[model samples]
Target: MPSRGSATTAVSGLVALAIAVGVVAMLSIGVGSRFIPPDSVLSALFSPGGGFYDNVIWELRIPRTVAGLVIGAALGLSGAVMQGLTRNPIADPGILGVHAGAAFGVVVAIYVFGLLDFRAHVGFAFAGAALVSAAVWLVGSRGRDGATPVKLALAGAAISAFIGSATSLVLYADSTAFDEFRFWSVGSLAGAKADLLLAAAPFLAGGALLAFGVIRGLNALSMGADVARSLGQRVRLVRGAAALAVVLLSGTAVAAVGPIGFVGLTVPHVARALAGPDHRRVLPYSALLGPLVLLGADIVGRVVAIPSEVQVGAITAAVGAPVFIWFVRRRTVREL
Candidate 1:
């Protein structure tokens, strides 16, 4: 175990890093087009109608920054919880099919039912994520011992594949659906609307709160179910609640931002590397770091292609895939 002073220092370092990243994200948000300076950006944020510059900051930069903040938090927290739940540093919400399920749900809503707007799609996507999670839990928890980490991971993979295939089939069958789904499936935060943010806020907020509650339980669970149970933690309830929170967060993020990849996978590992293994620290670190990674990527996406922005999803994949490969390669083949 690490010394107490060391742990505090580690958390302080991560907090500082996250704040620095957030500032960079803010700078990036104003760096393009009109190229507003940091002072102007601050003025815009504080006094929205101060001048023409303020309008640009309020209308353009603010939305993008807010989107980044929300989506980043969602992915980061989801990833940390997933890692803790499965005891796998490699675990992520996207890889487990929650995002795919939500994407599929939205496709079905738009294509089959013709719900063309963002507002109509959120509920469908949320329901779909909940359904996929339910399926994963049912299949994973089949045996006497309850869902082993291996079983849960495998179940998630299988379900993700099935849902992904279904999404493809739906797209291939309908050109109109393909047209709409094409951009969304890649996961960009650029097109998000204020209404979409409002719709997703409650779910995301509730999920984040619930996740924080489970930090102690997750820390105990890290020592194995028997150990956690002996310590008076209700293992099943804790795990179940965490999983529900994951569904809410990932689903809402997916609905608002599409099935963006890597935020969940990469942030948790980064958080743990910085904050140590305790879930108390890990969860908060992931929440902060997740947004930093995402917003940084978003800024990169904006600048990389100039007028033609690279999608945030694509940028994350480009960056995350190699890191994910490294994570897997470095990880020992333990149960989680």
Candidate 2:
């Protein structure tokens, strides 16, 4: 159990993070190609007078911003849950082959099936991700010790490599698919549509709720599988629930915004550092920090080049890779 002072501090940090998310969301709406003033952005959002900037805000920026928020939260929570379940500090949706699976599914839909529409690809992405996640789990759990953190990580890495190679081969063979998937592969919120975001809402919300429900189980698991089982935790059930949550959250996000990496890989560690080892606090902090990091990355992508924008995925990679290296080198990041 966390001390009262620690709990209070965590609560306070969450509140501060909530405010920061709000501010960054506003920036996401206001700071874009045209640079709408903050006052105008507010007016366009609240008043709804049907002006040009108002239309831009309502039609374009709002949807993207909302997508960013949802996707960020999903990735963050997914990362946190994955790390907890695998007992690996480095476990992430993208690292675990989920993103590669989603990407491959979308490519197959476009190349083989001729399904060009973004909305139509969502189901394929989810299916692919679910299958790959199951495969990773199966391989990881094969050993006598049963799905240790090191085994899970190694399994995920091998599977991800295989799927990635398959994805590349398919793309190399199909010009049309290559052209269509290149943009989506890089990942960005620029083309996010309101309908797509709306469609993804239920899955993201359900995943988040499911993740929160397993907080106690995750906390016990943190102490190790034997300890968790000894404490009356149903290890299989908890693992199943956590895996389902990861599939729902990670698959949907990949389907929506392509595979934005680093957010999942880095945000949970940041959350744990801030709020201590408690999953209850770590989950919420990750949710808040996820958007803060992603939206900030998105904003940077927008401003870095005046006419041409960098993809959010690229920005996250640039930022996250260094942090990942630092975490590995610091000797402070303990294996879960």
Candidate 3:
């Protein structure tokens, strides 16, 4: 058990992160292509009467910031859960094929159903992510080891490759499909809206609950499956629930922002480093840390190009890849 001082420190860190998230969210709202003064931004927020700044704040920045908040939290928390479940320091949500599955689902929606509406893609994304994740678990858990880390990684890789190739094949011939898919595939919060948030709310909420529920199980499981079972942790059930949570979180994030990698892959490492191995602390820290990085990246994307903005996905990847490499190459990485 943590000492009183340690517990207070953890709570303090969380509160600080929460405050940072608020600050960055406000920055995201204020520092877009056309900068709105802070006073006007506040006025729009406190009271709105259908003015220019009101429209930008309400329609554009608010939804985008909200999307950043939710998606960042989901990716961060989901990544932490994945790492905990797999007992791998580098595990991420995409290792379960969720991202590839969601991407393929979007492609199918555009190619087969001819439904180009972004909202129309959500159900298919959920279906694809769920089915592929289920398949990964089944295939990976085959024979003796039963969902061992290597097996799950290999299975996810194989399935992701096959699905990615199939998606490319569909897009190769259809220029129209490619045109529609290109915008989404890049991953940006520019298109986020209130309706999209409403569509994703249930899944996000469900995944967060499930992730939090498995905290104790993850702590036990980290000691090894045999030890976890002896500790009365239902290893299979915990893994299944974790996988489902990852699917829901990753699926909704992909559906919302078109597969913004690194948030789910990289943020957890930082959280674990700061919060230590106890998942109770790690998960909440991740929930806060993920959004801070993402919203910061989003703000940077908006300003770097001025009139034209880079996609948030690209910015995160550009920033995250190097940071991840540095973490891995570190002499003393934090315990998983």
Candidate 4:
């Protein structure tokens, strides 16, 4: 455990991170497609009734910025929850197959039902995520001790692979569906609608609350399940809560941004380095830092490719893969 001073420093760092994100987000809003000044960006955001900049800031940039923030926070928080539940230093929410399941749901909707609307996609995605999560949980818990973290993770991985293959087979059958899914599959914040954002909020909120509730339990559990059980914590309950939280958070993020990889895997590791391994400290820091990392990547994607913007998902994966490799090389994981 880190000292109190370290905690204080971490909190300060998070505050700094949030402020930095705000500033960078504002800069990004102003820098894109017929650049506006920073002052104008502020003016537009603050006084919506002011000028032409208001239209650009309020209509275009706000949704993208807010979506980036929400998705980033969701990924980070989901990673934190997954790691705690599994007690796996390298666990990622996507590794549970929630995203793949959601993608499959969306693919089915698109190809089978011929639904193309974002509104319809949101519902299908959530349903798919929930079903996949439940399936993984059930399979993991089938044998005996009710969802050990390792079993749960393995179930998720297996189920995810199956769903991914199903999606691929569908795509191979229908070229039209393949083209459409190709765009949505890359994970972006470009065309997010107000209704879609509203649709995702409940899951994000519910998941966040669930995660917060288990922070103390997670900290205890980290000490070892036997020790945690000795401390009167219900290991199963804690793990269940964490799993449920991951599903909501990770599912919502996938629904919002179409399974942008690596944020969940990468952000928590960054949080742990900054805030240490304590759940109480790690969770909040991950929440803040997650947005910062995501927003930074989004900004990079926007500028790196000129008029043709890069997908946020591609950007994150590009940046995250190398960092993830480094993490794997350095960390000596003791799986629970």
Q: Pick by TM-score: which candidate is best? A: 3
TM-score of each: 0.92, 0.93, 0.95, 0.94
Indicate which candidate wins on lDDT: 3
Candidate 1 total steric clashes? 0
Mind giving the per-residue lDDT tens digits that candidate 2 earns over 269-308?
A: 8888777888989899999999999999999999999788
Candidates 2 and 3 compared by lDDT, better number: 3
Clashes of each: 0, 0, 1, 0
lDDT of 4 at 326: 84
Candidate 1 residue-wise lDDT, 1-336, digit = tens = 866437668667776977786686777668765678777777766766756587666666778788888889888999889889888877877545687788888889988899777668778887888788788888887887676678888898898889989989989999888887776778887777676788789999999999999998898889999999999998888988888888888888887788788889888887776566888787888888888888888888888988778988999999989877787677722333
- Steric clash pairs (candidate 1): none
Per-residue error (Å), model 1, residue 239: 0.9
- Per-residue alpha-carbon lDDT of candidate 4 for residues 154-207, written as tens digits (9 for 90 to 100): 898899999989999999999988988887788888887666788789889999
Clashes of 3: 1
Candidate order by decreasing lDDT:
3, 2, 4, 1
Q: Give the least accurate 10-residue stretch of model 3, judged by summed lDDT.
A: 327-336
